[model samples]
Target: MSGDHILETQDLTREFKGFVAVNKVNLRVRRGTIHALIGPNGAGKTTCFNLLTKFLQPTSGRIFFEGQDITREAPAQVARRGVIRSFQISAVFPHLTVLENVRVALQRKYLGPSFQFWRSERTLNVLNERAMELLHAVDLQRYADLPAVELSYGRKRSLEIATTLAMEPRLMLLDEPTQGLGIEDVDRIRQLIKKVAADRTVLMVEHNMSVVSSIADTITVLQRGAVLAEGPYAQVSANPAVVEAYMGSANVELQGAH
Candidate 1:
């Protein structure tokens, strides 16, 4: 693995029974960049993500992170090495206040294993300033005192990002940060993603081509469990095989990126 690449997969494959969901994928994500993994449904994007996070072991090949082979590491082990997946892995609890939610993740990072409910309030308060800072980074500082369940879907996503931020990841895997939101919220999350990627590497599996094109430093297109194209938006979007795989109106969405 090169120093510039924060994450690398060497011919990674995953098989479910006789079906090959992710087949021989070779991905190299550069440090401090936003890389987008996109494909039509059942293209194995999610499977690839699961493999990267060690949520699913690869049937063949290897995964390397920061020059070390991490193929056999457990999910928690990989996470400790600074790969944090938001939304799923760093979920925000609905009952906890936004600040408290972030504090829980901080507790995991600063105080070890999560949900240390018996810890002194003074010890937990030690994390509040940092939690507020993370909340501010995601533009959710004003919602710190509010219950997470009352937040709008977009705000909830922001809170999730804030919690993920508390873990201080070197590589953040965002799964559809803008999946369900109005145009205004979509724009807000898009800008937030760019801002967050400023100091760390981001690898995301996103459906919105416009979002991918707008912020992704590199885009990888997957089809039928394999990589079809990988490059900047302009290059991959113009590839004929990529266009054909997208098939109908999705081609328009791809071109719309231009």
Candidate 2:
């Protein structure tokens, strides 16, 4: 990993039984840029994400963050290295107030895994100021008092991003940030991703070609677990092989996305 790139995978590969799910995938995400991994369904996009976060270990090859070999690091160890992942599904503490959810993350950050819930309110109050700031960053400060469950689906996703932010990640791996979103929510999350990427790096597995075209600085296309094309949206989208390998009907959508 050079100073110009925040994350890199050297022939990263994963297999299930006898089937190869990810094959010799070399990914290089530049520092402070929004990078996207895209392909048709079953292109091993999610599998690649799991490999990076250690949710699933690779069968071969290595992963590096800022040049450190993290191929064997545990998930917690990976996260501690400032590599945080947000799942495809909205992951929020439904019962906790929006503010409390972020505070819990802050507690984990400041107090470690043994964060004291039994501590005095005065002690915990110190975390509220920072918690509120995280909420404000995601535009959820107005809903601080409400249970996360009460929020619309889109807002719940926003809360998830805020909590991820509280972890102070150097590289955020977003897994389909707009997976089930409506048009409006998709737009909001797109802009939100771009905003956060201004200071830190982002590597995402996104299906929406429009979002990727609009926000991604680089796009890597995978086909049957291999890199089919990798470059800016314009360059990748123009590749004849990319157009042929694009997820069926999405080929039309990809063209229109531009």
Candidate 3:
């Protein structure tokens, strides 16, 4: 294991009813790098993310984070170790204001498992300052008082990112961060991701090649649950196998780097 890597998987494999969802795959994410996992429809990207986040236990293999073996750790335990995952669906509370949602996340981190519901208003008020800072980070300060459900699709995703940031994770695992958004929203989220990755490590599963090329420091191309190629955008984009994997996709061009 290299000292520079924040996360690594050794022959990570997962199976469902005799069907292999994630094959024997070894993955490494360097510290403070934005790494992307891209592939065709059934490439096991989600499964791989699940395995890393401990949402789904692997059938075999091991996971390591910050030089510690986390393969057998629970999801919450992994999260406490600074590995957090954001889902494809926005995880924000529908009725809670954006500021309140981020405050709740901060509460979880600071208050711990024995959090009391009857805590005084002053206690919650102390978290407001930090929560607003998080909202500002994701450009959600303007909508801080609005209910999460009232935001546009892209704004909801931004709020989700803000809440995740409140956890102060060392490695963030994002599953399809830009899925289902307009071009303008996609661009906004892309910029937000780049900004966040400046201070932490991010491993995301993204299909949009343009966004991947624009923000990813390293790209891992998967095919049928196994890695086909891994390198910088310039190298992986020109790989013959990667090009053939996305042969018919009009939007994904494996010849250019953004």
Candidate 4:
């Protein structure tokens, strides 16, 4: 693999009771780029993600991050290595205020399970300041004092991004970030994602072609359990295989529209 890639999977495969979910799939994500993984349902996108994040063990093949082998690492070990994932559902603490949520994330990274930091008012002041900066990064500073659950759905997603950012990930994996949102919410989160990705690499699985086309520097199309196409949006959209794969799918029609 080239040195430019931040993450790479070589001949990655996963099987479930003889059912191949990901079949010898090789994926490369360039450093500091926003890459999107798109495919029809049952295409093994989720399985591939679980494998990369170490949530599932690969039946065979290897995963590497920043030139080091991580295929055998535990989930928390991989996360500590700077690969973080955001779930489809917002991961915010519902009862905590937005600011408190971000603060908790910061604490987890720096304080671990030690409660001594909580006893130090001075340390908390420092953490709060850092948390506010992250909240500002996601445009959630204004909602810092509100309960996390009180924010709008889109804002909750923003909060999730803030919490993810607090972890200071090198390669961020976002799963269907803009799903089930109104037009304005979608647009807002799209912009937020672009902003956060300025200094980090992002690998996202999204159903929204418009969002994918607008932000993804590279696109990888998965079909069945293998890669069907990989290129820029324009190139991948024009591939006959890609067009045929999405032919009957309403959501993917936007991808081939041009």
Estimate every model's Cα lDDT from 0 to 1. 0.89, 0.91, 0.91, 0.90
Candidate 2: misplaced stretches above 4 Å? Answer: 117-120, 250-252
Q: lDDT of model 2 at residue 246?
A: 65
Candidate 4 per-residue lDDT, tens place, 19-133, comes to 9999999999999999999999989998999999999999999999999999999998999899999988878889979998888878866777443535565666678889999
TM-score of each: 0.96, 0.96, 0.95, 0.95
Q: Please identify model 1 stretches exceeding 4 Å from their true place.
A: 88-90, 249-252
Model 4 lDDT at residue 92: 82
Model 1 C-alpha lDDT versus the unseen true structure: 0.89
List candidate 4 stretches off by more than 4 Å. 113-123, 255-258
Model 3 alpha-carbon miss at residue 108, Å = 1.9
**Model 4 shows how many backbone clashes?**
0
State the RMSD for candidate 4.
Answer: 1.8
Better of 2 and 4 by lDDT: 2
Model 2: per-residue Cα lDDT over 44-128, one tens digit each = 9999999999999999999999999999999999999999999999888889899888888898878767767677878778889
lDDT for predicted candidate 4 compared with the true structure: 0.90
Candidate 2 local lDDT, residue 142? 97
Question: What's the ranking of the predictions by lDDT, best on top?
Answer: 2, 3, 4, 1
lDDT: which is higher, 1 or 3? 3
RMSD versus native structure for model 1: 1.7
Q: Model 3, 79-128: lDDT tens per residue?
A: 99999889998788899788888888898877776656577878888889
